[model samples]
Target: MTFTAARVIGALMMAGLGWFVSDLVRPLMPESTIFGWFNHVNLGLGFLIGWAMLGPKAGGGLMISLANGLTAAFALATVGLFTQAINEMLRLSTRKMYPNPLRALEDIFRILADYGSVLLHPTVIGPLIIGSVVIAIIVEIANSLWR
Candidate 1:
């Protein structure tokens, strides 16, 4: 789906804000911070922007997730981004009863996180979580607005 200028503008604005927040707070956070809250926030924002402007039916959220993941240094971010896309696709496929599918998908991510310490860069893991949340929130909001 073609992203309208509004979507791109909103997504970029949110992503920038997310990065700024993450950069500011990451230094004070513990090494073991659970889920990159900031990153997720940013990602959610991005998703919202894309989904709202491009239309949820256009698969914009999934595309945004992938783009954010690719930009990160952590393997966790990469995995989460791709997994989120898969999850989005699944939800898209089964339009009705998405609550269950969403839960299952998240559970899978948490399970994958168990093995993350071994492969993902320590620095990138937190941001990845943050990224996912950020994207999800944004996309959902935008999608709702559109609808």
Candidate 2:
């Protein structure tokens, strides 16, 4: 809510990261129908986490800010993963893929595990690690320059 320059920069940077990461993972997705709103969801989540989490820690200190940036990036990924898994679970339930509600609930975790394994690929993690560092440095620079 402070709406500082660092916040704006952080939000936009993370949003870009979101879009890029989504694109990277797109081909790995099992179903095409679920991708319609995927990018948008990631964008919003990234922006929110950046603005609220990373932005506030920008001026705190170099090490602290860097740690926070990495944490925020992981948070974004975790939330996005959960969001997509739940969406997929709901879709599957609607299709009656599970014989019972309990089985449907179990499938959510199964889907999460499956996607979690995919996320472990170097292709997905490498950029995220690199981007977090870059984003942290950029936001810290914006904070110092503006304030």
Candidate 3:
């Protein structure tokens, strides 16, 4: 893939976003042993999303950049949450919690729905929107400076 200042900055910003999101969700998680790689997964996913989505739109106007930034943020949140849900579903399935594969799959959605509501809280969404705006501004500036 092509390397650019925008990509580097975007990736770093989103990586931080992932870390922050993980921290926000920590208190919400039920008291249980968390998977060792949970935070790492979110970091890596956020980096990739930023590189692919936010980075490419860096040179755009403020509104366009904000639009893309918001889209990227939404994608990061949705995909990260979905990954966590799948992990939970797999954990349950391994313990023989589900009667069949279809049931296990359905649990993924149920888990997502449960966490989805929590994500809607003002505390969570406010930071997310603010972060996206900051990222968009910084990335746009980087694009102008570099190219």
Candidate 4:
């Protein structure tokens, strides 16, 4: 398959897998469980697997793998940010705090800021960095082998 086609399929498969895994684990785990962090790493893994599937002939190397991992991480973060924004907006609206779109947008920014602060904490950053590196290495190896 073409590289673009592979990437599309990989993204869809990864999204489905991520949704499935999140659903399966959510009910079984406590709110404080480390497994909560897995959602962020899922996107990186998906990118790695997708890129690796394209084989060495695709001309991607370590740099590309790292870039893809970063993209995945950012994508996951964006999704989380939007989800948080929607939930926060609903809660605020019910509390009569969001009477206008401007207020709602303000709440979204606040929510994003809160998440940004939390992301700086070691517990979150550590896993994200490690997971991205591991994903890059694995994808690099796979690409080399396929060459």
Which tens-of-lDDT digit does each residue in 1-147 have in candidate 1? Answer: 556443554466445644554554455545775443546754565555433532333234656644543343233344344554455445444665446656756655564454344324545455544654454445445555664
Q: In candidate 4, what are the lDDT values of residues 1-147, reduced to their tens digit?
A: 445543444455544444443444344444754443456555455444544442232237667766765655455546555665566577678788866878887788887776556655555545554554445446456545543
| Residues forming the 10-long window of minimal summed lDDT in candidate 4 | 50-59
Per-model CA lDDT versus the true structure: 0.48, 0.85, 0.84, 0.53
Off by over 4 Å in 3: 33-35
Model 2 C-alpha lDDT per residue in residues 1-147, reported as the tens digit of each score: 678988999899998998888888877767655687989999998888889888888888788877887797789879988998998899898888989999988888998998888777789877876787789889998999997
The candidate 2 region of ten consecutive residues with least summed lDDT is: 27-36
In model 4, which runs have C-alpha deviations exceeding 4 angstroms?
1-59, 140-147
Q: Give each prediction's root-mean-square deviation over alpha carbons.
A: 14.3, 1.5, 1.3, 6.6
Candidate 3 overall lDDT versus native: 0.84
Choose 1 or 4, whichever is better by lDDT: 4
TM-score of 1: 0.29
Q: In TM-score terms, which candidate is top? A: 3
Per-residue lDDT over 1-147 for candidate 3, one digit per residue giving the tens place of the 0 to 100 score:
899999999998988888787777777767785756887898898898878888887877888888887898799889988998999899889999999999999999999998787777777767876887788788888999997
Q: Which stretches of candidate 1 lie over 4 Å from their true place?
A: 4-10, 13-119
Ordering by TM-score: 3, 2, 4, 1
